[model samples]
Target: MLKVFLVEDEYIIRESIKKTINWAAEGFSLVGEAGDGERAYPMILKSEPDIVITDIRMPFMDGLELARLIRVKLPQSRVIILSGHDEFDYAREAIQIGVTEYLLKPISGATLLTAIHGVAQKIRADQSRIDYRAIYEKEHAEKLQLERTDFFKNLVDGKLSMSQVLEQGQHFGMDLSAVWYQVMLFQVRGRDLAEAVRPEAAEADRQALEIEDTIMDLVAVQGHAEMYEQIGDTLCFLLMAQTREELQQTETSLIAKMKKAAEGSDKLLYFIGIGQAVSRLHEIKMAYQSASRAFSARFFSDCSGIFRDTDAGFLPESDQTELDLSRLNMDKLDRRIVYNFLAGGTVTDVPDFVRNYLTGLGRDNLNSLLLRQYVILDSIFAMAAFLKKQGISAAQLEQFQNQFRNFNANLTLDQAETRLCQCFDNALALRDSQSQQQYGRLIEQAKGYIDTHYACEDISLSTVAASVHFSPNHFSSIFGQQTGLSFIEYLTQVRMAKARELLYCTKLKSAEIAFQVGYRDPHYFCYVFKKTHNLTPMEFRSQRGAKAAVTGGTDACG
Candidate 1:
C-alpha cells in the first residue's frame, strides 16, 4: 500500500480530511498527521511516505520546503499540495518544487483519490524499470561467464572448426578476429606442497590471479594480451604482439616474469610452452594444439624449452638420412625387434640385424613413425644440452644421453633387438608416469566435491576451496591444471549430470528438478541443460523411458 502523510495547521480540517478520505480503498495509508509543516518534517522523513499531502502556507517550513527536502532525500516520493489560495504565484512556486498536483483547500474526496492513483501508477512503473534492469544485469553477467567456458571447451574439444568457433565467440562478446595471437601453456608442479602449506584456497587463487595479472601487465607495457583460460592448474594465454620480433621479446619477458612469480612461493614451479604465431582464426586451434604439445614436453624434460611447430629445424626432415630408417621398409622388423627386446630377447649383429630382419618386409611398409622416433631421440639430447646451459644437473642429461648412445651404438642386427626392447620399456614407463590417474588425483578430489555440492545454489570455487581448505584462487589453478576443466565448466557439468540422473530416475517435474539442482529459475535451467545435453529435461526423460524422482519420491508435485 502507498503511504501518505498530512501536514495542515487547522485541527478540524486535518482530522476531517483524514477521516473522509477512504485511504484503504484507494490503496494508500495516512501514516502521519501533523498540525503544521514544521511539525511534520521529522515524521515525513522517518516514515518516508510515498505521497505527502500538505498545506502551502503553513507556519514555518511550509509545503514548498517539505517538498524540496523530500526531493533531495527521497526523490521517489511524490508531493501533492493543498492550499487555501489558488493564487497564480502559489501554484507556480509549488510546481517549481516538483509538487505533482495542487488541490484547492476544502478538497473533495473524488478529486483527491484521482491524484493519489496517478502517483501510485508512477511508482509502479518506476518499480518495473528497476526490476527489469536488475534481471538484465544478472543475465548479462551469466552470459559472459558462460562464453568464457565455451570458448575454452571448444578450443580443447576441437569440435567446431576454429573459424566457426571464433565467429560464435563474437556473438558471445569476444572480438578475436583482428587480434594477433600466440598461445602459451604453463606446466605446474608442487600441488601437494602448495595445498599443504597454504591453508587458504582463496589466497592461492589470489596469488595465481596476481601472477597472471603481473604477466599480462608486463606484456601490456609492450603489447596487448588476453588470457584465454586456466587449463588445469596451468594458465593459457593468447598474446597479441605487433611483430614477430615483439612476440619473441614478449615470450622471453613472460618467462622471466613467471619464474619470478613462482620463486619463493612454496611448492610452485613453472614450465612454460609457447606455440608458433597464427594470423587467422582458422589456424588458432592448430597453434593451441602446438602449445599444448609443448606444454606436455615437461613430462619428457628433453625437448626444447619452447617448441614452435613452424620452425623448420623442429619439423621432421623430408630427405632420408643414413639414420632415417625410412628407406629400410623396416616396420615389421622394427616391431619384431622392439617386441623381442621388451620380451627380454636380443639381436647379436648391428647392421646385419637391420638387413636380415627387414629382408622379408615390403618397401611400402616404411612410414613416418620410425623416422619420427629417430628425430625425437636426437632432439632429446639437444634438449639435455639446453637444460645443462640453464644450470640443470649435467649428470641427469649425461645419463639420458648415454642411453641414447648405447641404443645407437648397438645398431648391429643382434643388439637392435635388445636395444629396441629397452627403449620400449623406458618409453612405457615415462608414459605411465604422466598418465591422468597418476597426476590427476587432486583434480579428482576437487571434482568429487563439485559432484556432491553442485546442487547448492551458492556452489562456487570459493565454497569448493573452503571444503578442501584451499584458497579459491589456488584451487582454481590447481584444479584446472589437473583436470583441464575450469571451475565453472566443471560445476555446470556436475549440474547437468545430476539433471540427467533426475530425468532418468523419477517423475519429478522439470521445474522442481531445476530448483533441486540449484537453479532457481526453471526456464534458465532448461535453457542451459538443453544447451549442454541437446534435449529439454522432459524430452530427454521421454526418450529414455525414465522419470525424474523427488528426493523421497513422496511428492511429484514438489
Candidate 2:
C-alpha cells in the first residue's frame, strides 16, 4: 500500500482532511501529519511517503517549500497543494514545486478523494515498477549462482572415473554416490526470435526448465534417473538403465515428450539431442558435449527436430572423404563459383545440385562457414530480385551490386578458406583487439570498473561510458566486441558473479543482496538470476549450502 503524509497549519483542517477520506479505500495510509512545512520535511524524507498533501501557506515554511524539498529528495512522491486562495500566483508557485493538484482550502470530500485516488494510482504504478525490478534482480542473481555450482559439478564429474568418487567429491564440493544424476540441454534457436524475446528471455528460460521437469516426470515412471539442465541451452538425463537398448528407448520417449511440449510455440521451437548412455558420473560432460554438438547439427539440417548421433543415419561415418575446395587456386573465382551455385540453387535446382555434389565429396569435411557465406550471398541476390519485382529501379540494384563487389574485393577468399576452421576464433580476436585499441586501454580495465560500479543502481552504458570519456554508442560497440557480451549483459554477469559469492558465503536477504548488486528492485534481480542460472536465489543458496556441508563433513571424516 502507498503511504501518505499531510502538512497543514490549521489543526481542524489537517484532522478533517485526514479523517474525511477513507485512505485505505484509496489505497494509502495516513503515515503522518504536520502543522507546518518545516515539521513535514524531515518526516517526508524519513517515511518516504508516496503522496504528500500540504496547504499552500503554513507557519515556519510554506507548502511550496515542502514540495520543492520533496521534489529534490524523493522525486517519486506525488504532491498535492491546498490553499485558501486559488490565485494565479499561488497556482503558479505550486506548479513550479511540481504539485500534481492545486486545490482550494474549502475542498469537498469528493474533490479530496479524487486527488487521493490520483496519488494512489501513481503510487500503485510506481510500486509495480519496483516490484518487477526486484523480481528480475533476484532471479538474475539466483541464475548466476546455479550456473557457477553447475559448472563446478560438471567439471569435477567430467574428470572423475566411475569408481573414483572420493577424488571427484573434492572437486564437485559434494558427496555424489547417493545423489541421482540427469543432464538436460536447453537449446535456444531463431536469432530473430531471440532478439525479439530478449526482454522476456527470463520467462522463456523458466518455461524451458518446466519442460525439463515434465520430461523427468515422464521418465521417472519408468526408472530411476537424475536430470540436470546445463548452463548452455541443453538438457542432460543420467540414470541407470537395464541395458543399452532400454536407455535408447527411454531417450526416444523423452525426446518425443520434449518435442510435443516445444512444438507450436510462438517464438521458439525445441530440438533435443540425447547422448549415448554412460553409467559413470564422471563422463557426464562428455555426454553433454556430444548432445550440445548434436543440437548444433540441427542448424545444418531442418529446424524443430530431435537428433541422436548414435542413432542410425544421424551422422555419416567419420571416414567420409573431404570436400577438396583446396584445389581451386583462383580465390575470387572459387568464391564466385560457390556464390553463383548457391544463388542459382536458391532460384532453381542448379545451385542445390552443385551443393549436393560438393556435399557428396565430403559429407564430414565441408566448410559450414563457407556454406553460410554462400547462403547469405544467395539470399542477398534473391532479395535484390524481390526488390525488382516490387518495382524498385535497376539503379538501386546496381548500387547493391557495387557494394557487394566492394565487399568481395576487400575479402581474401584464399586466406579466409585457409583459416576457415579458425574463422570464428580469428574474427572474435580481431573484433576484440580493435575494440580494446579503440577504448584506449586493456579490456580488463573496463571490466574492473564495471565490477566495482555494478551496484550503483543507476549504472548504465551511458554512465559508464561517460566515466571512461567514451560515448555510450562507442563504448557499447567496443565493450561487446572486447568482452563478447553487450553492455547490460556484462554488467548483469558481474553482478551475478558477486551475487553468487554472496549467496554462497553470506546470509544476506535477497532484497538486500539485490541492492548490493546495484539493483534497486530485488524481484527483477531474481528474475535475471533465474534466467541466467535456472534457479531462484534462495534455492541456489540452499543447494550450495547443502553441498558445502556435505563436502565439509566428508573432509572432516577423512
Native-vs-model 1 lDDT? Answer: 0.62
Give one digit per residue, the lDDT tens place, for model 2 in 486-527. 677778788998999888767899999988998766767787
The reply for model 2, stretches above 4 Å from the true place, is 1-148, 151-153, 161-184, 191-232, 239-246, 311-418, 428-558
Candidate 1, residues 112-166, lDDT tens digits: the string is 8788888788877677566546545654554465466557657544677767776
Could you tell me the TM-score of candidate 2?
0.35
> Considering summed lDDT, which 10 consecutive residues are worst modelled in model 1?
341-350
- The C-alpha local distance difference test score for the whole of candidate 2 amounts to 0.60
